[model samples]
Target: MKLREEDLMDILVGATILGCGGGGSLEEGWKLIKRELKKGRKFRLVDVDDVPNDKIVASPYYVGSLGGNSKDNLAVKSFILLEEFIGEKFFGVVSTEMGGHNTAAALTTAAELGLPLIDADMAGRAVPELHHSVYYIRGYNMCPFSVVTAYEDKIIFSRTRDDLHAEKLVRSIVKVTGANVGVTSHPIRGKIFKRTIIRNAISLAMDIGKSVRKAKEEDKNWVLSLLELGGFLLFKGECVYMERREGSGFTIGEFELQVIEFYLKMRT
Candidate 1:
């Protein structure tokens, strides 16, 4: 499927909902799409099967806070650098996680560079840490990693003994860069990617987005649309209070939604 300009809206919304509140921001996602579309760039969407086993794939994503200055095309730069370092061409770009910004990382870079965007992603949903990656769970090594910042600074790790060490390395790099950086790694075979990736997850996200829009058009509860997809609606209410703590290159936070009566209480 070719990603058209308008598809950005539904895709972003769907990815955000899939994020479950931990995914990258919707605004940042739209910004990347709009910027690329305005530049007349085009991107092709392909399933895992579309890419051959011998083909190389790179998953690109931001490794820092979404609110930071991440508008730079560092991920794309990293991809280019990786190709030069490996002395080979990358066949496609992939999303590390399904989120507004994370999804855009692959799409925007693929579109701009004329590479295919893999239909599946490393993580089916947005997660707070790199250790949450499906690739790590599936026994893929997080190595030959590349990191880039807006300053055009670049670092590549030939290999990491483990994913935990890889995540720690990324956090340390982000701190040293003093800005959010783009990361892409594991230039593995498409066949390996097919085995590890959450297949057709992007298509599911697109469908969910469309359903949510249709539900709104019908004046129905949109959350029910997600419930149909094995998702539970935990609660529905306005946020009353929100707090967050920033440390160790991460922000942790919690919030309370004001919903009275008929509410089930659980201790955290």
Candidate 2:
């Protein structure tokens, strides 16, 4: 599917909701999209099943805590370096996870590389650690991964003891490289990727986004429509208290919602 401006906004809205407050910022995602659009780049998504079995694909994402000041094209740079190191062209780019920024990172990388963005991702939701991916859970190796820091420090791991160790190593690097880096990892053939990925996840987000947009356009109740689409009304309240801190390359935070009422139900 070719994504237009409206489609980008819809995806961002849906992905942000799915991110559960951890997928990077919507403003960052929009900036990436607008930058690519200004360059006349096309954003396209392809189904996993449509990929050839022999084709090679990789997941591109950012790793580190929120809030950073880096002007380098880190994700794209990492992807290019990985392709050079592997001596093989990537057939497509898959997202590491769905979120405002990560999804935009993957999409922009695909656009810059003139490749299709796979509609699937390693994780259906934004996760805090590298080990929290479906690929890791399915025993996929994240070897030969490339990491590019904001300061232009590039490293590639031919092997790692495990995904958890990989996460630790990257976090340690982040401490010196401005607390953020772009990563391209888990280079896998389309066959294994299809089996391990959270299939149609992008489509799911797009559908939710479209529903919400339609609701807004028709002046309908978006919350009700979302519930009808299998969303649960978890809470209707105001955040009475909130605190957040950055540590260990992760955002540690807490919030208390003052509930007006608890209306939890699943629409049939």
Candidate 3:
């Protein structure tokens, strides 16, 4: 699917809804879209099967607190480092999660490197921790991945093949690097990638966005659209209270949604 400039807002809105509480920085997502648009560059969504099996493909995303100036050029720098480490150019990018900023990383990094953005991802929805990814659960090659932060911190994991341990090491580094880093993990062949990745994820997000827009235009209940699209509505209410805390390189919080006569308690 072609990632048109006009489709960006719908995609952002859809991705945010799919984020399930943890896709970062909507403003950053917009900035990325504008930057690539100004360069007369095109952002495309490539089918995963179209990627050459011999080439390398990796997931790139921001990992840290959703605050401050954590969103910037970190992912591009991290990709540069990944290519340097592997001694081969990445063939394409697969987003780590579906969040406003994270999902748009697929577009931004592809434009930055003149590469393809695969229409797939490690997770179909946003997750707070790296270990929650489908890539981690499938037991792919876990070593020699790159982590680069704006603070000039560069760390690579090579010794351990353990995914959980790798996540722990990265969490510690994120803390040391002031709580956020850009990561590109385990570029693998297309055959292996197919086994772990959720397919056609970007297009699915765009569909979600389009549905919401149509619902608004028709003056229909937008939340029902999500249900039609196979999403379960967990709550329907107004936010009564919210609080967040950053610690141990993780953001933890809770919120209350008042559903008329009752309240839905949630945590993340």
Candidate 4:
């Protein structure tokens, strides 16, 4: 019960705050994680040092879709599909991608599997695609990986030597799944994890969230504290105009935001 309901809610809200306006919504991600938790399940966290050297590691998380009308709580079924497709007992580290929702999703899987979850991640920051991970650049395998789509709960099992191919396959499946399929990839060895993974990412995120909470509770500046934690300065602007549409699973568009006497272009 280390990750209680209140803890999950705090983490979700804190992550959205930490997201700095670009990470996925806390509400959607929280509902997904909470729904799975309510199934009377348990989750655990493990330090990277506890993992074995040669054991396999993988990350299962939500992929596809951005913004409104995204995927929801059915992601648990995806995990079940993944286990069915692997058809073998897995013993290794479990990690996350980078979004607030993905981070929670990874932890939820670890909790359900009774596996020692690693605090690291493939991407130090959340990106729009799968292959954009340090694991992809480090030559990790993406097969023996599991993906659950929306078609009658059928799981797609993929094994690829190249991570990009795996990403492409996942994207294609997402298109078929209505742009929001759950996926797991970048199977790697535990011993070499330190080399390819972004160390302490989960814990780092947790710590960041905690700091923000403490700052807010103490009537201090959350923004300043958050910025000191790793957030980069994007810009300051007022919403003047915007347009967007989903194209190939991405909400492609541009926004015109006025900032004093300056303007900036942001993709929404």
Candidate 5:
């Protein structure tokens, strides 16, 4: 499906919620979307099954803490380098995780490259470490990955000891790159990609976004709409305290929610 600005808004809203407060900021995501739309770029979403089995897809995303001022087009550069290194044209671009920033990153990359954006991702939600991806959990190789920084530093890992080592090595690079970098990795054929990915995740996010938007338009309770969409209302509270810091290439923090109400459902 061809994506419009409204679709991008829905994606931003849904992915932000799915990010669980870790996939960069909503502002950054919107900035990227607006920039692309302003440039007359077109975004397209394709289902996993629609892609030819022989086709190759790659995940392009931003890695590191949410706090950063880097404005370089690192993700696009990483994709270009990876495609050159692999000597294969990518059929589509897949998101590394479902988040405001990363999802937009993948979408913009696809739009810029004139490739379709796959409606799937490695992780259905944002995760802090590379090893948390389904690709890593399923024992998929993460080599031949490209990492590029805003400062024009680039490295392609032809091999790694394991996912853990890859994570460590990337973190070390991130520490020097101002806490963020762009990465493209996990090049897989469509057959294996469909099996390993969190399929239809983008659609799910879009659905959630559409529901909330409809509720708002109808002057209904968006929270109730979310509940109807299979989301649990854990608590309604004000954040009394938050301590966030960028350390070791990760954003570590804790927050306390002073509960105003809590909801629990009983199943029988």
Candidate 6:
């Protein structure tokens, strides 16, 4: 898969739109994606059929406190470090946990690597922990997982017999990275991918993004336009409560109205 230099911004915009309010801020995801684009990496989106059945596929993304660090900073380049540790050309596949940011994180990596991203993810919705992926439920091992963080000063490498252990080790590394570290996990074979992945998610995200962009430009009502585009409203409410914490690690939290109405778990 070869990426063109021009499409990265549109892709990032679309990914953030899919985030449904909870994904990482668009400023952060776009800043990292754009920097990679400037570095001359053009990514391609890959279909599940394109990967070999026996080869390993991994998902890399950001994990951190989404509160205090909400502002955009173009200096963040954690994905490169994670990719460096893997020490191979990667095909950015979305993590099983779905959010605006993770979905975009997959494409941004794909664009930067000039590789075709897999259309599927392990989980179809946002999840709080690493072990929550559908891949683990199917008994897949998490070998070849790498955790990279700026403060860690070194890439953490692991070949785990179980995904849970991989999660445990990576979470420890997240602390070193200051609550928001980039992680890549879930190596899978191409053959198993046919059965396990939510196919064409990248393209779907792009299409959704295009529609939203059109709607915004045409001055159409956002909610109505989204509905017209076949996206269901998952939630709609004013923020009534919010909080923050610094426990074992940095923590940020918020609550808003019309709960779960906008949470559309895209089908593979």
- Number of the top lDDT candidate: 5
Ranking by lDDT: 5, 2, 1, 3, 4, 6
Ranked by lDDT, the better of candidates 1 and 5 is 5
**Model 3 Cα lDDT, one tens digit per residue, 117-190:** 89887878888777777767776655678888777777777666577778888887878777578888777888
Q: Which sections of candidate 5 miss by over 4 Å? A: 266-268
Any runs in candidate 6 off by more than 4 Å, and if so which? 1-7, 67-96, 152-162, 176-179, 233-236, 244-250, 258-268
Please list the C-alpha lDDT of all candidates, in the order they appear: 0.81, 0.85, 0.79, 0.64, 0.87, 0.59
TM-score of each: 0.91, 0.95, 0.90, 0.80, 0.95, 0.75
lDDT of predicted model 4:
0.64
Write model 1 residue lDDT over 1-268, tens digit each, in one string. Answer: 8876656677778888888775677888888888988899986888889989998998878887756566888878888878877888989988888888888778899998998888887788998878787878888787887888878888888877788888898898777766778888878887888788888877878878888888999999898777777666556678899988655666578898886534355323
- Poorest stretch of ten by lDDT in candidate 1: 259-268
Quick one: RMSD of model 5?
A: 1.5
Q: Please list the Cα RMSD from the true structure of every candidate, rounded to 1 decimal place.
A: 3.1, 1.4, 3.6, 4.6, 1.5, 5.0
Task: Give lDDT: candidate 3, residue 159.
Answer: 61
- Model 1, backbone clash pairs (residues 3+ apart or across chains), number: 0
| Candidate 4 lDDT over residue span 37-152, tens digit each | 77876655567776677666677777766653334433445655655665644454454555567666776666666765676777766677667777667766566666666564
**Greater-lDDT candidate between 1 and 4:** 1
Return the lDDT, model 4, position 134: 77
- Candidate 2's displacement at residue 203, Å, is 0.9
How would you encode candidate 5's per-residue C-alpha lDDT over 65-178 as one tens digit per residue?
A: 888643677899999999999999999999888788889899999998899999998889988888788988888987789999878888999999998999999999998766
